[model samples]
Target: AQSVTQLDSHVSVSEGTPVLLRCNYSSSYSPSLFWYVQHPNKGLQLLLKYTSAATLVKGINGFEAEFKKSETSFHLTKPSAHMSDAAEYFCVVSRNTDKLIFGTGTRLQVFP
Candidate 1:
């Protein structure tokens, strides 16, 4: 079975500063990882994904994550933060032919 754990349940960041959301995973086979963001009472938007591709994967809106096989980690990072970026983030993991396993979710609160 494949599973994903988001280490932080809530993260607060100041506007214009960097943002980091930690995530870890466990999988029986090679996995495909993804990051998705959700706004208040809205659907999820796919931020980025790693599918046996590059370890350092870049996403939209200046967000990026590095997949580290040795550490079993896929940590999301952003060079700068914006108020609009304040949303719930989820770390997902799955196999090519398997269903997705979603993390508990990390809520980001951005302050001016």
Candidate 2:
């Protein structure tokens, strides 16, 4: 069974510190992993994806993740948090179609 597990359901960060959203996954194949951000009243936008390639992958808006096969994890990280970063984030495991098995989103609340 291929699925993603987000360690936290919610994260609060001040508008300047770093952001870390932990995610762990289980898969039968060397699956594809994705992090998507959903702002208020908006659909999900891809932040990053690991397709069994690089160990460390970078994506939009100063975000990145390192695929650790041994750990069965791909955790999202950022150097700085922003007010606009307040949103719901989903860790995804996908094979075909954009149809991803999404983790119960981690709601990020940014404090000013």
The top-ranked prediction according to TM-score is 1
| Candidate 2 residue lDDT tens string, 1-112 | 7899999999999999999999999998888999999999999899999997888999999999999999999999999999999999999998856578999989999999
Please list the C-alpha lDDT of all candidates, in the order they appear.
0.96, 0.94
Show pairs that collide, candidate 1. Answer: none
Which sections of candidate 2 miss by over 4 Å?
Answer: 96-98
Please report how far candidate 2 places residue 37 from its true position, in Å: 0.6
Residue pairs that clash (backbone atoms under 3 angstroms), model 2: none
lDDT of 1 by residue, 5-105 (tens): 99999999999999999999998778999999999999999999999989999999999999999999999999999999999999999888678889999
Model 1 off-target regions past 4 Å?
A: none
Error of 1 at 96 (Å): 1.2
